[model samples]
Target: MFTLFRKEINGYLSSLVAYITIGVFLLVMGLFLWVFPESSILDYGYATMEGLFNTAPYIFMFMIPALTMRTLSEEQKDGTFELLATRPLTDWQIVWGKYFACLLIVLLALLPTLIYYYAVYKLGATEGNIDTGAVIGSYIGLFLLGGAFVAIGLFASSVTKNQIIAFAIGVFLCFFTFIGFDSLSQLLSFRTIDSFIASLGINEHYQSVSRGVLDTRDLVYFLSFIGAFLVVTKTVLGGRKW
Candidate 1:
């Protein structure tokens, strides 16, 4: 597992993929937090990172899929997976190895955004006026949320050999998982179970955690959701016997 992990990480770092992914993510974030009028901190005139927190998940919904689209898809397409699978690695190792590598890239992408936080921290009328707890909680929520999307993206990649198709599948699945259930809860037909239905989606748990509450229920939901998708990805890899 560690070998596969290192290899995958090296693959990303050795190429332009890691740098490009981080650059694009940070670029879009910079645009939203600084350049864009509506979400720009300059326009808000507050130390709060509500703009960053509120819009990050949506950015992640697309960014992660683009990163993971080639994880398994490229391997499968290039016939490299056959050789890798022939080695002693288990399917879980392969899945996790690639998963963590992609996740590391995501974290690296997020690392630069701390500049925005610091800028906001000092930009306020009072130094450090920003809500530290909420910022920390939102960062945690974003990490877990990104993890869930990585798992979903891996599953999407596992199901196909075409990177474009994998990317599309990943984005669609992430969007639906993040917001579809919440939307479904509003339907008149599901009024009785609306809350319960909403609770099933990432948005509900994500919103709960973003409030700086650190609820165990929300944490469990993210972990369970990630685990379930990774397992499904392993199953998909297992099914491809050769």
Candidate 2:
């Protein structure tokens, strides 16, 4: 597992993918928090915390796909995938190895945001009276949200050898999963079913957890989503030799 993990990590770092992913994430966050006139830029009396949380999901929508686009696609495209498959590694090991490499990049991108938190801390009227709990909660939600996106992206990459196609499918699928159910809920004629549909979306659970209220159901939903997608990715890769 460590060997597979190191290989994937090296693959990402040796190429432009890791740098681009981190650069885009920071650029988007900086623009929203410091440049956009309507929100963080004008100091409209709203906390940066809100701006950060609100803009993060959309930034992640693009960044995660970029990070995962070449994970499996490049391997298959270059014919190195079969070599790895025939090695001693199991499907699960490869899946998790790649997953952790992407996850590490995501986490590294997130680490710089601590500066924002510190900036907010010093900028507060009082000495750190800001709602740190909610900020921490939102960060947790973002991590889980990114994890699920990575899983979906891994699955998408496994389905095709074209990196561009993998990226397109991964982005659309992530966006759909994030808001599709909520949109469906709005269009439903029956009120009871509408609420159920809304509840099924990632946004609903994400919002709940972001508020510093860690509901078990929301946690379960994220875990289940990640697990389900990872399993599917494993299955897809497993059938490569068949």
Candidate 3:
């Protein structure tokens, strides 16, 4: 598993995918947070990093699929998946190894965003005026959200040998999980049912954690979401034997 993990990371680095992924994420976020006049912090007249926390998930919706689309799909397309399957590693190991590698790249991209937090912290009307707890919670929520997207993308890749197809399907699935459920819930008139349905969506849980509450249910939801997709990916890989 560790070997596969290293190989996956090395493969991404070898092709400049890691650099591109991090660069694109930073570029987009930087434009919205600092460069643009309307959304820029300097124009907001407030020292909050709220824009970043709000915008990042949408950015991640696309960024994660772009990163993970080729993970298994390209290998399958090029017949390398067969070679990987023949290795001593189990399907779970292979899935997890790839999953972690993708997740690690996402975390690396996010690391530089901490500087935004530091800047906001210092630039506030009073030093340390920013809500540190909320910032931390939002960062955690963003990581888990990215992990969920990676798992979904891995599953999408496992189902097809075409990277483009994998990316499209992964993006659709991620979008549905992130917002579709919440949209559906809004159609219901009953408050109880509406809230329950909304709770099933990623946005609800993400918002909960982003508020700095650290609720265990939100954690479980993210873990289970990632686990469910990963299990499906493993099953797909296992079924390739037929």
Candidate 4:
């Protein structure tokens, strides 16, 4: 498992995927936070990071798919997945190794965003006037969100040998888990249980955490959400034999 994890990390670095992923994420986030007037923090005249937290998930919907699209699909397509299976590693080890490698890539992409936080922290009417609690909570929520998305993407890749197909499936699944339930809950037909339905999606818990309150329920939801997808991914990966 460790060897596979290291190989996956090395594969991403040698292929420049990690650098490009980080660069593209920062570029798009910078534009939304600075250049785009509508979403720009400068135009808000406040020391808040509402735009960053709100905008990141949508960007991640696309960006994370692009990053994880090849994690397993490329291996399957190139006939390397067979090599991986013949090794001593178990199915769970393979799934986790790939999952962690992809998650670390996402963490690298998010690290530089702290500069934005610091800038907002200083740009306030008073230095460090920002909502420190909220900022920290939002960051935590975003990381959990990324972890869930990576699991979803890995599952998507596991079921397909084509990277493009994997990406499409990943994006759709991410959208469905993240916001599709919330949208479905808003339907007139579902009005009676709308709130309950909304609770099934990631956005509800994500927003709750973003509000600077770390509810154990929200933490449990994220953990369960991520774990469910990863377990399913392992199931899918193991199913290749039968």
Candidate 5:
């Protein structure tokens, strides 16, 4: 598993895909967080990084799929997937190895954005007017959200050999998982059912976490979501053997 993990990471770094993925994520985020006149800090009239936290998940919904689309899909297309399955590593190991690689790249893309946080911190009228705990919680929420997206993308890739199809499916699944439930909850009239429906989606938990309320249930939700997708991905791969 470790070997597979390293190989996957090395493969990403050895190609332009890693740089391109990171570049795109940072560029899109940077544009909203700093460059764009309207959303930029200069016009926001505040020293908070809320724009980034609010906007990044939307960008990542598409960006993550692009990163993971080729993980298994390209291998299956090139007939390498069959050869890989014959290795000592189990299906879950392989799925996790690729999942971490994609997640790592996305996280690295997020690293540079810390400068924005620093800029916000310093740009504050009082040199520290920002809600430090909220910002920290939001960052943690974003990371978990990214992880969930990566797992979903990997599942999409596992189901198809066509990268474009994988990306489309992944994006659809990610977007639906992120917002579909929330929308459904709004349309329903029952208060209990409404909250339950909303809780099933990513946005509610993300919002909860982003508010600095570190609820264990939210963490469990993310972990369970990731685990469920990975298990499904492994099942998808297993089916190819039969």
Candidate 6:
């Protein structure tokens, strides 16, 4: 598992994928937090990073897809997936290895945002009375959200040898998981069922956990979502060998 993890990390870092994903994340965050007019951090009038958090999901939508699109698709395209399957590694190990590689890139991209935190801390009127709890919760929520998306993206990549198709499928799946439920709930016939439908979405749980309250249900939901998709991806890959 460790060997596979290291190989995936090295493969991503050695290529332009890691660099481009991180670069795009940083660039978009910078533009929204510093340069954008209506929603700029400076215009928000608060020392908190509400603006950053609000813009991060959209940035993540693109960045996570890019990070995950090529993981399995490239291996399949190069005919190395069969070689990987024949190795001593289990399917779970390969999935996790690739997952960790993408997660590492996401975490690395997030590290630079701490500078924004420090800046906001210094800019606070009372020597930084910022809501550290909320920020930490937001970070946790973001990580879980990324994990779930990466799982979905990996599943999509596992289904195809073409990275572009994988990317498209990933984007659609991610978008649906993120916002589709909420949209559908609005159109539901029964008001009583609306809440249940909306709660099925990633955004609903994400919003709940991002408010500095770590609900066990939300955490479980994300973990289960990721685990389900990963299990499906493993099953799909296993089918190839049979």
lDDT of 2 by residue, 120-175 (tens): 77776675857889999999999999999999999999999999999999999999
Task: Look at candidate 1 and tell me the lDDT of residue 116.
Answer: 89
TM-score, model 5 to reference: 0.97
- TM-score for candidate 6, residues paired by index: 0.97
- Cα lDDT for residue 88, candidate 4: 93
Query: What lDDT does the true structure give each of the candidates?
Result: 0.91, 0.89, 0.91, 0.92, 0.92, 0.88
Model 6: which residue pairs collide?
A: none
Off by over 4 Å in 4: 189-192
lDDT of 6 at 115: 92
Task: Quote the lDDT for 105 in model 6.
Answer: 87
* lDDT (Cα) of model 4: 0.92
Give the clashing residue pairs of candidate 4, or none. none
What is the lDDT, from 0 to 100, of the residue 120 in candidate 1?
Answer: 87
Minimum summed lDDT over a 10-residue window in model 2 is located at 39-48
Which 10-residue window in model 5 sums to the lowest lDDT?
A: 37-46
- Writing each residue's lDDT as its tens digit, candidate 3 over 119-218 gives 8888888888877899899999999999999999999988988899999999999999999999999999999999999999999999999999999999
Q: Please give the RMSD to the true structure for each candidate, in Å.
A: 1.1, 1.3, 1.1, 1.3, 1.1, 1.2
Question: Which regions of candidate 2 are displaced past 4 Å?
Answer: none
Question: In candidate 1, how many Å is residue 203 off?
Answer: 0.8
Off by over 4 Å in 5: none
- Please report the TM-score between candidate 4 and the true structure: 0.97
Residue 69's lDDT within candidate 3 is 94
